[model samples]
Target: MVLLGCLVEAMHANYHGSYSSIQNRSSSIRVAHCMTGTPRTLYKEEVYTAYRHQVLDVLPGDLFVVLEHINKTEMIHGTRVRADNAIRYKSALKYLSPRIVEWISIGDSLGSIETRSGYAKWKRCFDHIQRTERINGMKYDFIVRTRPDLYFAKALPKPSKLPKDKILINPYYECVNDIPSGYDRKWAKNLDLCDLTNYGVSDLFAIVPRALAYPYMCVAYITDLPLAICGERAHQAECAIKATLHKANVTYEFWPFVVKIKHVS
Candidate 1:
């Protein structure tokens, strides 16, 4: 039997919440929190406040952090955050002190907006896992991909061991005409129009063994743009991931958990 190991990839913004809850439950799990995009103006201070409170208090097995800087000229929701300000905002991460941290430069030049974004998201998570394995010289049994902006109501249950070809994904809240309702209406409607039969995997979280994660996360690189771009941004993301997983020939099962999205304040 494969030994139980986990690598938690928390990508996106950091809001207030104790990951310690998870550590308390499983001391062996390694965490890689990846923060991306320009910080939202509405909750800039709040984001830092939460990061300092929750992320800084790392547990014993928390591996490292990947801080990817967004381009200053990039407009996210009509806001262009200055590079200097981003640097300043990231400076505070010093409190993570003894923990290993890496800063990566990111820009719009990576590829077409949708494809590049999807690629970057998956690449960061995959890269970190590879890095940890290299440094520790050990392979992980499972990899958990998640977002920092989310707050889990309780400890996530330990993933059950599965055949190397199988993965564990959370079921989407709903599917409107086969389109995931978790996406915005425009994207959802567009996806529904496309009528993709096997397109309901929630991108929010996934737990898979290292054997399958390599192919699953590398989907962005191999995705067919013409097919994935049929829907809006979120829809494009869904299609890319789903398409890639299908090509990789991986089967999935859902692991239930209660998680809530923390709004920007």
Candidate 2:
């Protein structure tokens, strides 16, 4: 949902500890972070340090990252990215120790705005997160699907304070909290209060429950089918997410947390 300006790169990971020993079994709410996307100026301390203070300080969990395989440079939407920006993402590893890191060669497939292709890529990310979770023998109460570039405007709500059955997403349309104002206006068109009545769901971020994680993240699987949400409309990113949830009969609510795509580079 975010049109990023910075070049995307894989994290230069430095694993210092095993997650098995780090996670506290007695923690009331266990969260899993699935990070996909290039955050602007990731190497800066101001970015990751804020994440540590605002997000991890409230909800600590294992981090899963899927980055595009980029070389020295990449040009997207006529924007040229140099080698200096490539190395910036590496600095993020020092702050957030990731659990599983994977890379893929996206080439030029994502040069334009195509909903199906976008969701298909997300499908792979979801697969990686779920696959590693099973192999690691870890189960989380909620899975947070977000981007490394997201600027958390508010601390994540404690698990006890959120609804257990609904998908949590950034406020959109006419939902509660009036949908914060700092985010990109393009993403604003999709929130629609995370409902199907108007726009669709906000694709920028989603807090999926373990029960509906597959249906929520694996939306590429159901993008073609006639959805009950809009009934045979054009394939859209928000529509695809909302339709899949409708099929699963799962509802979504605004998380009340504000996040904007951080553009530092």
Candidate 3:
């Protein structure tokens, strides 16, 4: 186990090629975007078109895109926005024909309806992933939960490590012990002191196959952190946690790509 972990460690350092190099690449491509719409409306294709053009024009490859749908409360014009997300997924796949887009739906019945309620629903999505993993005959290989309103202003990047068996998530976002309330640090630290080699996990994005994501989500869900906290914190916490897990013998990595976009409509 130790030998295998050592191999993953050596490979991670070499893969990043120094922190500055990764940061330079990240600055060049920002991926997440926020889009606004009525409950039952289909997202505009033009927006997606423009986003794809901007990001893909810079980098191109197989991309794993995770879209999360929130709030199943409103029944709009006989249609649920949660359902609309699946439709949007279809539109995205068709609109962005050239790029490989894999979509996953994580929905909740809580949110804006009430802050506490919303958090509860978010937790459900995480619980679902964990339960799904125990099924005897399941199909999904990867599972992700993200905000429904989020849009991709840029093209999503291909995960650096193999996606099937490794856990990958944005290393820049994770839970930490102590720091300024709003300070942003792009480096990975604090989590550098653990041994987790029995599992293959990566920083930030937690890029893993269906098998690993299931368990990872279970942990996140059971812990009860706010969605926004999870998302924003991953930017820094992910790096630290991923590195710590890696050092502990967890086989994981930090994937480089544009993962954020503007929230403006």
Candidate 4:
């Protein structure tokens, strides 16, 4: 196990080149973006034209993934596998495993169902990542949660540049996707973290350490984010995710990476 981990880590470091920053990371890391929300008809083409160049090519790992199963696709592995909706996924199958999920109707409000499903995607993706670790008897040093649709003008920061104990999030906007949600560290200071937590973390992307992966990925496991955040009944993402994080006492830092959710079509 130790030998396997060292080999992957060495390879990962080589990808970034030999530098002092290389010492900041101890093991191999996997970065991923989830393909979720409403799928566009031309999504596959966009992946090659935009996402691949702007996001994937810039990042260091091949297993880069988020959640959401597109088409009949499955998830995270130690090898290079692309999980997408109606897209072709892969060059290696030796470490790839498809996650079969059975869907059940929530009958909740449409927003609620969407919210739960989104978080479930994160949870399930991480589970698959962890499963891969077990199968190979090795663990990733870090895990990144992102969506494939975010248009990035610059490369997301590598895990070596980030702190392991803090869940790294983007600076929040007052209204993302026309919703009144976004997180601010200043506003959260010294207050009941959960009370102010309804002001959600920008879900654009997050960098998580292995220690905090469970709390970071289990947002779907919570029964009601709106109620938990501010006593409402239905609010889908950001603020809801904030409530879950604050409740878990998870610490976070806003990394200065700039990106926006762009329409694929």
For TM-score, the strongest prediction is: 2
- In model 3, the worst 10-residue window by lDDT is 12-21
Local distance difference test scores for all models: 0.47, 0.61, 0.34, 0.47
The candidate with the higher lDDT, 1 or 2, is: 2
Q: Point to the candidate with the largest lDDT.
A: 2
Give the range where candidate 4 is weakest over 10 consecutive residues by summed lDDT.
10-19
Q: Candidate 3's residue-wise lDDT over 108-157, tens digit each?
A: 22222222213332233333333232332333434433333334443443
Q: For residues 155-229, could you state the per-residue lDDT of candidate 2 as single tens digits?
A: 776666556787878755345436454222223324444444555677777778877676776665553443456
**Residue 222 accuracy (lDDT) in model 2:** 54
Return whichever of 3 and 4 wins on TM-score. Answer: 4
lDDT of 1 by residue, 94-128 (tens): 44331334444555323223454444555554655
lDDT of 4 at 36: 29
Error of 2 at 188 (Å): 16
TM-score of each: 0.57, 0.72, 0.35, 0.58
Candidate 4, residues 27-101: lDDT per residue as tens digits? 355543433233322244444345555544554443423323343334567565555443333311112221222
Between candidates 1 and 3, name the one with more favorable TM-score: 1
lDDT of 1 at 84: 61
Flag regions of model 2 displaced more than 4 Å.
1-22, 70-86, 108-117, 173-196, 227-233
